[model samples]
Target: MRIAVTGGAGFIGSNFVAFFCKNHPTDEIVNIDKMTYAANPMTLEFLEIYENHKFFKIDICNFDEMENILNGCDVVVHFAAETHVDRSLQNAEDFLTTDVLGTFRILEIVKKSKSLKKYIHISTDEVYGSIEAGSFTENSPLNPTNPYAASKAAADLLVLSYLKCYRIPAIIVRFTNNFGPFQHPEKFIPLAITNAMENKKIPLYGDGTQVRDWLFVQDTCRAIEVIIDRGKTGEIYNVSAHQERQNKQVLFKILSLLGKDENLIVQVPDRVAHDRRYSLSCEKIQELGFEPVFNFEKGIEVTVKWYERNQQWWKTVKDKDEFKKYYKNRYPGL
Candidate 1:
């Protein structure tokens, strides 16, 4: 099989690529990424030893380039997007351009592909907005609260439309919060983990009670594999580990793991239109025989240890001027 993965240099995508390469060494893997600030070559450095894996630094928005590269690929996993809610709140143009328009470009190319067997569009649970009670099923209506979630929701609809109008073999996978290795330091888990390593104050937004379902990155990768192997076309699968944690709880856990004082936390203003909670009923995907291997406790411990051992990796990312500039602007006092 020849698999083409977009945004494979980023956190979840890189982990998926690594997982796939390890499991199926003989299958040809083509990784496409825009090499954004969140994407680092070092994340994929280990793949250099794999002969069947290839990398292309290409923007998905460039329709011509995407069309040419995606030709003859058997499978396409679309993971490329402007995903940070805080960044999207600052300026929505990048989010709309990359998440919506870029996805449109990929769908255009995909609808024309004769060799493509599957096109998996990765979405997020944030698209359903927040729920005070009850988990959202795949049938729940999209109620995006932030610009980032709105953009992904638009892309999800576009993919579904193409599946019906153009008869493309496509499916959408809505994932909850995923945290593990190679995640940018700006993200919650990584930020807390790295911040504590330096004994720097970790920023907590507005009392830090927002709830989110956490999934291990590897478990997400496994869910993708199941979808590729047996999932039906033109369907939406909500993949979650059923691990719910509050923002403060997650930070406290990280602090406990690192033996750091809770005083290292700095309360900050909440994000614009921040959703209070995001929960998904994974019964749909579960029916496909997909189950997460890592619970929050085990997953978080593994993640903390990863940041501990991979000091150089996170350090290199944090040392970049882009990261520094963004950090200073996002949290001025911190």
Candidate 2:
């Protein structure tokens, strides 16, 4: 099978490329990526020797570019987006353009590709907004609180609309917060790990009581692979490991694992309109015979070790002038 994966240079996207290439040696993969600031071409350096893998540095918002790449692909796994919530708060325009409009452009091309068997859109459970008491099911109403979630919610609706109005074979999967190797340090898990490794203060937003459901990247990718092969068209699947923990708890876990002092944590003002909690029900995806293999403890260990071994990779980006400038401008006073 020939599969096209957009945003294949970014964290999860790059992992997906590696996963697909390793697992299905005979399958051909066309990686379409925009190579944004968060995207690192070096992530896929190991896949360079794989004959079945191909990379195209192209933006999904450009219809002609997307069309040219999607010409003969059997499936399009759309993972391209500006996905950082904190960054989105600082600059929402990029999120809207890349998440919403970019998705529309991809869907438009899918509409024209009659041979396309599936279009799997990688989404987040943040679209369900904060869930304090219980998890959000697939049929739950969307109440996105931030611009990032709102943009993702909008793009998700567009994917469903195409399924209903145009009979496009599209499926959406909303996953929990993902962690593992190769994640940009801007994200919580990597940020905390990297900061702790460097003996720097790990900034905790607000009292650090906010809750998030965490899932390992490889398990999340496996679930996506299962859905692509077995999920029904026009269906929405919630992919999670049911591993919910408060932000403070996650921080403590990372600190304890690293044998670091808790005093290094610094409480900072929370992001604008930060959701207090997020959780999603994975019953639908579970019914499809998908199961998360990594528990929270094991996942964290693996993730922490990965960051330790790959110091050069994250270190290079962590101290770059552009990365530091963006962080300073975005999180002023931090």
Clashing pairs in 2: none
Candidate 2 residue lDDT tens string, 220-332: 88998998899998999999898989999999999999999999899988887889988887888889999999999999999999999988889888878889998788666
The candidate that wins on TM-score is: 1
- Cα distance off (Å), candidate 2, residue 61: 0.9
- Tell me the deviation in Å of residue 168 in model 2: 0.2
Global Cα RMSD, each model:
0.8, 1.1
Best candidate (score: lDDT): 1
User: Model 1 reaches what TM-score against the true structure?
Assistant: 0.98
- For candidate 2, the per-residue lDDT at 305 reads 96
